[model samples]
Target chain A: MAKKKKAFDKLQWIAAYKSFVLEKGELPATVRELAEMAGQTFPDFKKQFTDLRQLETAVIALYFKEANDLLMADEKFEEYSNKEKQLAFLYVMIEKAGADEVFLQEFQRLKKTDRGFAVRLMRFLNRQELSWAELSWGASTAERVGVNPKQAALIQHALSTLMFFLKDYSEEKQDTDAYIEKTTDVLYRLTDTSTVRSMVDLGKFLFSRRKTTFSWE
Target chain B: MGQDKIAVSKYQRAGKLVNTGAKVGANYMKHYAKKLTGSKATKQDLEEENAKDDYSAFSELKGGPLKVAQMLSMGDQVLPKAYVDQFALAQNQVTPLSLPLVRKTFRKYFEKDPLQLFDEFSTEAVNAASIGQVHKGRKGKQEFAIKIQYPGVADSLQSDLRLIAPIATRFLGLKKKEVAPYFEEVERKLMEETDYRKELQNANEIISGCGNLEGIHFPEFDPQLSTDRIITMTWLKGLSLNDWLATDPSQEDRNRIGQLLWDFYQHQFHLLRVIHADPHPGNFIITPENELGVIDFGCIKHIPSDFYASYEKLMRSGQEQDSPELIDALFALELLHDGDSEKDQATIMGVFGSMFQLVGQPFYSETFDFSNDSFFEKIYSTGMALSKDSSYRNLSARGSRHFIYFNRTYFGLYQLLHQLKANIHTGQWTFIAA
Candidate 1:
């Protein structure tokens, strides 16, 4: 009789990989260790990913890939404005990465202790995010707007909001909705005239001692 | 042409206000100067001309000025009827963002094109309001009415209101001090309205609060698709009051619809003490079944327990016609001061008594027929007479500032009921035991 197959799909494998790195506080050195963390054997892990390095790379790509899948699965995604698609993309990634206090703490710890690993991880993340920005926003529009600055600002914004969310998000209660709104504000301010104007006003307010009184006309 | 985006900058908003103020001032000066020079215009004609200028300037403004315009239009004592008629347009006849600009706004809010978010999002807006415009959209099988606020509305609200305060008080026919609390109340509620997430929370609470009430319905709000500036709720199918009236439904139809509205306010006030305060005709819809569909929760007002208790007591005093009880109630409401002289106290009561009498009229009846043109005419005439009465004019805004909204709510309800000509059973919520 044929051997029983493991239930480890690509998404499950990605989840297992994330948990393995985050729980172990480092990348898994071997497939056996990753499989053990995933509650499967080495053979089961090999069926999904070839090696530890490949699995790590897949984990990064999977963030956007899975997010894209979600966007596609949502019938309304195509009908949404470009901004909404971008927000939905970011939300799905953050949610998939397990936007919780524990995840935030572990990630912070990894960044502090393992400089080389953090650099490699962030480089991959930055690359994937840029690709998404270009894809979701459309190449022509993204090109005109200079996708790099927008992408960089958005990534930094997403991280900053995650840190803020960690302050309030806990095991017993998670205010992801609030975090989504706060983070979305950054995107809005960056792109919309109103929010951008407010940002400029805020900057002026901070810099000037006297309050500015502009005309109502 | 101006910035290619909704000019939500405080400087821009203030600029608009200043320019409008200057123009209005110039017109007033010119009118007086013209009158002194023996022009053919009567005071009524001059008033009409001034009203025209005020409307043109205020109607161009998108945020605070328009909100104040709507509020002033609701009060009979606040503005001349011509000005009120012009300001009434501010409630529903708002300019819309261009399609490209609309797409840009969506892009800013969602970071994706709106087309990619909904299954079928209309580029054309179905309706527009002072704060935002509404678009019809579909996600799979479900339809939604997505309200997207004009950009920068929330960010610039404080500054806009600051600029509007002096100008608005003059328009509302109240002293700055007298109107401050009401402005604060409006500011608080308007701030909440800009935050769609808060509206979502309010919607859920209101749904639960009024879920058991018959003949009233609320749309299901989708949190996943909602943001502070953008709200997505299930599409409520119905006609606005004007549209329904044009269709000429039967008197029985009108009464059922009217009863639905009455019960909604009564249930909300006596039990919840939380009201959907913006009862502007645009905020409600009459379904094919004559059910009342409440669409906006942007201006939900929660009455303080003390205020509710005191107001209830005042109503009771009116019912019993007890002078001492009325005085006690006014004191409780903080409308009457302990330091007031006996003569001043009597003057306050004399002014408030007429106002209270009009307010209490419906409550004294078993079934009040609002369709009686005479009832509304009497109320309006009394309001005009009292406002002109030098003694009443001297009475500063007394009582809790909450009464501003409290009175506005009943006035709005009464106005709509009168339009519908529905006979409603009143005196039912005469007492609140709690």
Candidate 2:
């Protein structure tokens, strides 16, 4: 009779996967190898993940989830403005990523070999970020006319920041921190309705003046 | 309203200073154009325009260049009133670090969030320091003032000074070689100011040295809680000197506060040899008990024995205009260089002689009335006359690097006293001639 199949939790598989990538300096060639490294059966690994790619996506998503969980745990998180929430999330995510250098290294390496996987991971992350942004902005404001553009800009910002973080070599990655602060500040300023409102006011004045000039002509 | 975010990148900061240079060049072009058109644009008008442009840029940069501007403004004798007026504004307009950034800095230094370390930490900065912002924090019954340095300030300082050097030389009307030492001096002090650990050590040294001095107070620093980028000290409860002056304190009160200020500086200069060289009003506080509070020890200048000897001689001989001893001391201090021609020497001696005599008047007296408008008028006119004098303009910069901060210290002290309108005894220090 075959040995009884032991059930392994998803987190245990993730923990095993992260250490394998860190130690071997590459992802396991097959799920069987990862399960064997973790002293578990291949069926147990298959129970948690469909493939190594799915496992990779889950590992990346775990960073986001952990970052979000940390932010949500903060009592002040609820009181934060939308901009502050976004900033807090970025800072916390970078911090989380910083703590897991092996995972980031592997993620960067995977991006070079598997562009499709990188895209999928980014879309997954973006969806998570967008939902958070919507929650912060409230459904009503999130559905407003200009917010979609702002959300699009924010997603692009998040992507660029991730790219920047991968290349950041400053002491304590302070350059990345400063970049996030400055760009987010600019984005919020650009999307601010007051500026749009003023432009509208100017347009009205210009149109009224043009009409009067036409009448005079 | 949100605080203006600081220009953070090296390129961004460098661009701002470069923009000032371009603006100054544009101003000059405009001045000449106005002249070609026979417009009534005097040199003063061009200078005022240049100064305004420079100030706006420095205020925006708000790190090294802004500091240099403040130091230049304090040496009111070297700059025009227009530049002085504009650059003096650099003292107040600093953009604070965001709350998240502040927490990030705290975490970097302390390995924990500010809120985690303190029982109650302020999310908003209570005040802005030159290179950092001050936040109030509390732990149980203990209240603390925490100073958090802006990110990349230290790293960018060297580049900022490099960019400012040429502009500074032009603005001061001196050769690059002539201004190098002063910039070097300012650069060193500014670098030291960015290191909070050094500042904590400086504060401790000053407090221990001047701790026995009457009517003055210092905050107890917490070294365990302090780091290179953040300083945690017991919170000082007081009004800033300017605010204290606003409450319309009596003449006696002003004199008392002024005496304490005078004694505090004199004690540092005479006995300790290391002085809190930054004497700006913001660095000082008048406690609710009306005692003097010295809050910042960031820019402490340690006077070398040789320099202090010459300085002492200069002060003692300053009252004697045209005296050989005074000229000898001036040469010793490098205020009169060996390369100077007789004409240049005479020009420098003539201007600096009368200037020092007036500046040294307080030391000459048992008690000097700082409120005497004529006294400040003489100083201002001497400065104005020196700036306008063509012969003086031709002379190269001829002062020791030490003089940059040394002159700043005295001039700032004089300005503070003048603002206080206090009459205080100045001949009490041990170094003064009997």
Candidate 3:
């Protein structure tokens, strides 16, 4: 029997895969080649990743994982409002991706090969539910309960930010930073219901103050 | 905290100006409509209404127009009293950046959150600067004040001025061509004010040059913690000049502080030849020990050698109504044009001569009492007369571009002293022979 294969850490394999791609400027042609380059046996590599496609997906997932881990590591992360939490995540991720030219180039190639890659990746990242406030409207009894609207918004924001980051060429990507700040502000403001409440209040005030006129017809 | 978004885009800012213009136009129409019916409304009433609308618009659009309003109001000679009173409120009405935006700016420059960089950082701003906001932070035993510039202020400045040009031309009742050079000078200085690195350099220069001036204090800046948009400096604990005045200090203490202020400006003007052009009360602080704390060094004007020589000559030729030397100096200073007809030249000289005599009174004497309200009243009446004089208005703004901030410095300094009501020896500087 073949020697019992050692347990292989997925993150270690992803790191090795990244170094292999960066050094050679291309992905290995086969899992065997990647495993050999990483100085690991095929059996151990197979235990961690089924094929090159899985490994490739894992690499992109690792980026998001690391960004999330960094955000979670911050002591103030728990205290931040949901909007701030989203902003911090975008800032951290964009800054990290911008600094890694090699990764960005690889990401571009992957995007060309798979048009749905970003959407699928965003969906995967959005699996974890956030504790967002819910909206409800009723008079004593609940008539309608609003679902959390942040999931779709955050996914859309993340994807657009990634696309913007790829094209942003401002010095130190400052324009991208400004874009993120402005868009995030507008997005959160759009979701806030205070404007709608104020509009209703204004409408009631106008109706109450309406002038009643009597004319002989 | 609630985010109060400042109008940053050129279009949004321009739209605000358009609104003000329409409102002002409406006010004029109303005034005329009332006048046609033989109503008792006067032009002064119209002016007061216009000034209120203009200030409301400027205060909303904070960066450039409000700054121009403040500068126009500072001289108290250029604008009517109603306008001066209304625009003076722009000094403290700047909107502050939100906490998230502040964090974003910090991350952009330092690649770390402000909380991570400092041992303790306040989420809320302590005070608002013209182009930025200041937050208090502490590291171990040392306290700091960090000024963070609002986003896109520098980029939007040109467009802001472009939008304000037509409005200013109409408001100041000057031809657009006449306002161009002065606006250009103001635009250049406003651009410089946006660069915190230049402010850092200015602070360092002033501190090194006047470090030994008694009873005057400058903050210690940390370059390592500073960036192009964020300035980190040691916090100077004190009340603003207005606040200090409200404390009901003794006349002796007031005179002491006033003397220090006078000497500070004199030293910078004469010896260093580079003066802090912004002498607004907000830039000053009175320490607990009654020492003067110069908090801001954002607007430093380096007097040109030629301008200085001519200015010195003009001051020395004082009380001589039409001496050739005085005319020559005035010509050199660009206050009188060579193309002016003899009558216009004489009229201009007579006006400037008396104006200079009254303005230069403090410098011409060993001691002067600023508490004498009649003196200020005379200066105000002279200014009002000049504003109303159709002959003076016909002549375009004749002085060199340097005169804009230079006159502002003196006017602001005089106003500060007047507010203090402090009598002190004013002829202490050697540049002027009393």
What DockQ does model 2 achieve? 0.38
Report the alpha-carbon TM-score of model 2 versus the true structure: 0.86
| True lDDT of residue B5, candidate 2 | 56
For model 2, state the Cα shift of residue A43 in Å: 6.8
* lDDT tens digits by residue: candidate 1, A25-47: 77677888778766788878778
Q: Model 2: how far is A90 from its true place, Å?
A: 2.1
Model 1 misplaced stretches (Cα beyond 4 Å): A1-217, B1-12, B22-44, B75-78, B100-112, B168-179, B319-322
What fraction of the genuine interface contacts, i.e. the true contacts, does candidate 3 reproduce? 0.06
lDDT of 3 by residue, B285-354 (tens): 9999999999877898988888888888888886787888898899998888879998789788889888
Full-model lDDT for every candidate: 0.71, 0.80, 0.78
lDDT of 2 by residue, B231-295 (tens): 99998889999899999999999999999999988888888888999998888889999999998
Worst 10 residues of 2 chain B by lDDT: B1-10
Ranking of all predicted structures according to lDDT, beginning with the best and ending with the worst: 2, 3, 1
Query: Please, what are the lDDT tens digits per residue for candidate 1 over residues B1-434?
Result: 01112333467667766776687677778778888898865666666676776666666656777777777776443456677678877778776654544554566568877778888988767898877889999889989999987655665566778887786677657798867887888788878887888888888877899998888988998887788778989998889886898898899998888888888998888888898888888888988888889998888888888888888878878544437887788899988988877877887777677777776788888888988877777777887887677876766666787877787888888878887889888767755776
**Proportion of the native interface contacts kept in model 2:** 0.26
Q: What global local distance difference test value does model 2 have?
A: 0.80
lDDT winner among the candidates? 2
Candidate closer to the true structure by lDDT (higher is better), 1 or 3: 3
